[model samples]
Target chain A: MRIFEYMGKELFSRFGLRVPKGRVVTTAYEAAWVATEIGSVAIKAQVLSGKRGKGGGIKFADTSAEAKKAARELLGMKIEGHTVEKLLIEEKLHIDREFYLSVTIDGGAKKPVIIASSQGGMDIEEVPENKIVKVHLDVELGIHPFIARNIVRRLGLDVGSRQGKELLNIILAAYKIFQEKDAILVEINPLVFCGEKIIAADAKVIIDSEALFRQKDIPYIEEQTEAEKLAQDLGISYVELEGDIAVMANGAGITMSTLDIIQRYGGAPADFMDVGGGTDMEATAKALEILLAKDPKVIFINIFGGITRCDDVAGAFAKVKKEHGIPVPVVIRLVGTNQEEGRRILREQGIEAYTNMDEAAAKAVELAALVPAGSL
Target chain B: MAIIVDQNTRVMVQGITGKQGSFHTRQMLAYGTKVVAGVAPGKGGSKFEDIPVYDTVRAVLQEHQVDASVIFIPAAFAKDAVLEALEAGIGTVVVITEHIPVQDEMEFIAYAQRKKAVLIGPNTFGIVSSGKCKIGIPPNQFFMPGPVGMVSRSGTLTYEIAGNLIAAGFGQSTAVGMGGDRIVGLTFIDVLKLFEADPETKAVVLIGEIGGNAEEEASVYIKEMTKPVVAYIAGKSAPPEKRMGHAGAIIRRGKGTYEGKVKALAEAGALVAEMPSEVPEMIRKLLA
Candidate 1:
């Protein structure tokens, strides 16, 4: 769950991190009012995607009129599939320098790591390795002040100076937020050095979805795509892809392997849909209906039945085919746990169920080739 | 030569009074696993399937000299259940519960490391030493005692590959589901080293997905390994940043990618199969 920038800043401020006074506005008029209230405002588009500055989604306005114009222009603009419905208007500052800092779970290390860089306000990838500092925090030891001081020193800031002391406080406070919030990532891009104080100019926070039960009162903004919403409604796992063929499986690993085989056989998967274990007829029909709604040229269903009976999947595919009077080609590979009975049911419905995954994937890809790519 | 459990290994089923716990406990018993004891907090002084039940792992340890523990507890109480097993000096703990929070996982992992215990998973199908002892919910008929040691991240994928391996005349010595969650207990490296040491295992089949650098890290270990390894990396066609049902199956920052994992395994001299069906043939050729 990603908290919006304004909410991130609000959470950061609550944790003792210094942030510029900001207000979230949904309209250009509201943005203008906030800009007038706080002179020299920065109108930052409220979108989840990064690189907002490079995308021209963020703009600086010296006057209220200019803020309103910038808001109007960015309000309806699209950045990485997210429409800018809101803007975060904040008091702009005269920054002496900018530094990037973040606390995120280093997947490789399986631990929380603090990433600090002297070069900030841009992509961390662009920064050289020598300038960036990474410190992996141990579960037993945690983030010590000395660790923060070392990172501060590596950032070329004097540990004895006032600005350095303030930066250390910010890093410690940010680490506190990372621990308290059960956050997957908490990043403050451009922790600006303005005169005597340090301010967080932009903030990003992603809370762990599994930790939501413990993290009460967090304003979690779940931005699900339409397909994702429908999949969630049906209690199925679905992820949309950029292709012309829909793929369905009983398990995540099998689904992925199905996608691999389809692509290997010169086909592209339109979406990934896993019906999960022991899915009955109604749920299977719903899953197929959801995939059909995407209007793919081909639908491939792969089920290595195991404890989940193949007859259950077969009956569901038949029921779905009959109910929708399916137009697109449906290829199913059902094996193990009553596979013969499953194939018999599919045959009764005038549908063929292959026993081998390779044969079924090949057939699906061959059928998919009959239609032009992306024609769906 | 099974790595984790065998006929001599005495096992205890934690949370054996619950629905999933009781069901899989029965399955494990039927599979000839020596399930000596059961731990259900409120269901003490009771017998589940004629096996003794205790309120806690410590009490269960008093009656039976259990060597390994299989946990079927809910995700909320899994941390305590695992710790209880470790506290009772149980060296091998297999957590079959899914959806354990990452923080709890970190704590338990650290605790397990301190105790010098082998923790399998908080979300796994559990380990099965083929035709000898089985734990957790994998369908047992798909397996047979053979020379190929299998390790995988996903449950159903393990079943599929194991079944295919059986059909292709290459039964497994032991199949370990390392769990699909982001923070699993026994990683690929841990199990790969076990397979390398087990004398009965002639070769190994590693099943991986687009997840944390476990596979990439395993590839580095595999480079140093002498035994032949065959790998099948899933999500080859999966889109970047899309969570493919598994909590750990997303690619971020050019890491944990299907292509990167496959390339790394290939570079390490492991045959990377395109699909699960192709795994058995590759493993057979390696052993041949």
Candidate 2:
């Protein structure tokens, strides 16, 4: 999950890392009050997205009136589809130099990697590979002092200088946060040197979603759509897409492949929903309801049940069809465990089910094409 | 003649008395797997399905000559469970548990490599040697004994493709689910090497999705293999930055794109299928 800048800074402060003093506020009045206390402030929109500055989600103010004006403009502003609900009013820094540092998981290497560069406050991807230094660390032997020192020196910092020592300590602290907090990414873009002090100008911390059960104290912002939240509650996975056919399947791979097949047959998928393994009648019915809410031209249900039973899924389609009556053209390809019984259940509801995935997908695409544009 | 599990492979069930454990245990047993023992802490000295249940793997090791152990422990305690199995000197460990912390997985995967052991998955459906042994929770009816070896990152998709292959008169020698997590124990290259050496496997099918560079990396290895490989990648139409069910199934920063993976596989001489249904026919043509 993506942590807000203020929250990430709070975590960094807990690890003895220096950060500009700031307070998150939801109202312009509070923003003005914070600016009054801090003298000059940088009003940053607290949304979980990058390039906020380029998107006009960030502004600077030297006076209380200017802070209030900036806050009024930023609050409720949309940047990259995220509404600005909170603003971090922080003391602006006078930086002598800017550098980049981060600790993130190297998925291909299967290890934690430290990425440091002399360039800062820009997309690290655009930076030339020669300017960036990456070091993969062993989980067993964490970030030793020498490794941190070497990283600092490689970025052109003298090991004996006080600035290098401070940067090294910050790097060590970032690694500590990455390990102790179970974070997938801990980035401090533009670790600025202001006269005699170094401070993290920006904090981007993303914790491992699977490790959230252990990191109970971390605050989570509700960013999921209504359908996504419902799916999460049902122990299923749902991702909304822009298409005419709604796709549902028993596994992530099969669901994605089902979408691929629909696209192959000149049809677009409206959403991706996986009912998950071992989904029973009620969850399947709920999944159907969620897909129907998307109001696609066609509802394609594909099940290659392994732990999930076809009969149970068919029972769900039957129950939903009887209760509310499915309004869309429903195409199902049910196979695997108890498939004959599943087909029987669907047949009783006057719903013909296909056994072959290709044929079923083609039929759904054909049905979807029959519906005129804006007919729904 | 399979690569990993065979008829002679002795298996043990971790968390044997739990809901998922006992249920799949019966399925494994029904499929003719040589399940030798079970481990459910505090349920030691008990018998589940007449298989002696011990509290720990070390205790179970005293009696049973186990070749592999399949775990069904929950995510919270999964680390210790995997460590226990590994420390007790089990050569092969298959973790069926999903939602295990990636840190714990990194630790165990590194440890497994250090010990020179084969660890299957932290979130996988498990491996199946057709007509011989079944380790995880795949439907037994879908598999048939034949010559095609399959490896996939997804579970039911493996079953779907396997069913299609069976319909085309192509049975699998062994179908392995390399797990769905970002950091899995085995990679496409690892399993591809195994299938390359196994004489029973005449052709290979690799099912990959949009995530990481696993398939692109595997494409490099596919060029070196003499065996025929048919590849089908999912998530061609999937949008970027959205986690499509699996944690690892997302495209970030324009990396791990479908086009990149498909082009790499096709350029490396693997027959890349446009759809899952096309995979069986591709395998047939290659084998023919």
Candidate 3:
């Protein structure tokens, strides 16, 4: 879960971090007022994804009139497919130096690792190796004063300076927030030093998905917070790998088997999604919205029935095909419990069903191979 | 020698008074798991499935002398419940509850490691010790004591593989659903080591999904194992850049994906089965 800048800054303040004074605005009028109050503000479009500057999501304006214009243009602009719904206008800082600091879960190590660097405002990834210092911490130890002191020293901060002391406090605060929020990553990209004061210029936080349940406010913006929303939305649970053939199966097992079969037939799967055990007509139709939207060359539905009735799955496909037309070629693999009824329904409707996973995979691969290279 | 739980393992139930806790508690009981005691705050003196219920894990442990626990607590209470169980000297703790906070899990996993205790899942189905016992929510009908040891991150995939193994005239010594959470207690390598040491288990089946380097890390261990290991990775049919499935399954930039793990495992000499269903057959061949 991604929390917006304003909320994150509020958290920063609570943790005794020095965050630059900022106010969020929803409309251009509000942005203009904010610019007037802040004086020489940085107007930034609220985007959840990283690299907002690259997407022209941030603009600096000297006057309120300029701030309004920038906000108006950014209000409805789409940066990285997310429409800008809000704008955060912040007070500009006169900075002498910028530093990088973040704490993230290192999944491989099964512990939280703190990364602090002298390189700031540059993507932490692109920062030179010498500029970046990584600190591996055992979670059992939690946040120790010695580790915090080491990070401050590694960044080459002048411990005697007031700004250095302030920056150290902010860094420790960020780590506390990371631990408290169950954050996958909490980054203060440019902890700026402006006239003997350390302030957070920009903040980014990525919360852990596993921790969302305890963090109640996190789900208010969730894609599925209610049963009604889930019932209406089409959600296929599977990872999307780099492949060309798309597979739709009833269970996770059959979906994986379908992927294997496709690979064996000299083709790669475009996606892996299971419609779950015995889905509804609307759900099947929604699955198409998710699967076909990927624009795959071909689709193969592998349904091995048990609690998941085959004819019900077939009926879902038939309904989806009738309502929303699918552009790509498709293959149906119906087996197990409702094999007879499902096969008969498909055959009667002039759609073919294969009992063998290999044959269906082969046909899907063949169809995918026929797609023009440029089209694919 | 399967991982985590095996035939001789004794199990206790945590949060046994709640609805889900009671229901799965019955299922675990029916599966022949030696569920000696139950724990629920102020719900002691009650009997669930004819098993003694205590107010706390400490009380349950003192009376029952049980070392392992199956947690049926809700997500909100999951962290504290796990902490209580671990603090009570439980040897292996299986947290069946999903949605544990990552911060809570980070603390729990670290604390458990420090205590030298095995914590299985934060979002797990639990562990099955073949026909003798089940300390979690796996359907009892699919398992029979045999030579193969299985460990998986996915619940249903574990069931499907175990079912196929049953159909193939093979059975399992133990099947551990390590849980699909990113901060789960036991990694694939942790369970693989136990399987390697188990005497009853001749081979191991590892069901891996597309995400994380857990499988790759386990593959390194598989090469050192004396037993044959069959491996299968899900998400072969995954679309590019889609973050579906479990949170751990998300594809990062240049790390923890299906393709990289596959190459690593294949090089480690584990026969990679692309299809989930074929894993049991592949294991059978490897064991033969």
How many residue pairs clash in each candidate at the backbone level?
1, 0, 8
What are the lDDT figures for the candidates, one per model? 0.87, 0.92, 0.77
User: On residues B107-183, what C-alpha lDDT tens digit does candidate 3 reach at each position?
Assistant: 88888888899988877767888877788776667778899888887766676677778788889898888877776
Writing each residue's lDDT as its tens digit, candidate 2 over B3-93 gives: 8899999999999999999999999999999999999999999999999999999999999899899999999999999989888889999
Q: Which residue pairs collide in model 3, if any?
A: A240-B239, A241-B238, A241-B239, A245-A270, A271-B237, A271-B239, B1-B198, B1-B201
**Which of 1 and 3 is the better model by DockQ?**
1
Error of 3 at B249 (Å): 1.7
Q: What ranking of all candidate models by DockQ puts the best one first? A: 2, 1, 3
Which number leads on lDDT? 2
Model 1 alpha-carbon drift over 4 Å, by segment? A322-324, A371-376
State which docking tier applies to candidate 1.
Answer: medium
Once fitted onto the true fold, the runs of candidate 3 whose alpha carbons sit more than 4 angstroms away are A28-39, A63-69, A128-130, A136-141, A209-219, A222-228, A231-376, B1-3, B17-19, B165-170, B236-242, B277-288
Tens digits of lDDT, candidate 1, A110-191: 6788999988988788899988999988876787899999988988989999998999999999999988888888999888
What does candidate 2's lDDT look like per residue over A1-376, in tens digits? Answer: 8899999999999999999989999999999999999999999999998778789988999999999999999999999899999999999999898889999888778889999999987878988999999999998788899999999899998989999899889999999999999998999988888997999999999999999988989997677899989988999999888899999998999999999889989999999999989988999999899999888999999998778899999999989988988999999999888989999998998888998999999999999999999999
Candidate closer to the true structure by lDDT (higher is better), 1 or 3:
1
Residue-level lDDT tens digits of model 3 in A277-349: 5466667767766677677888888776644667777777777677787677879877655668877777766
Ranking by lDDT: 2, 1, 3
Clashing pairs in 1: A245-A270
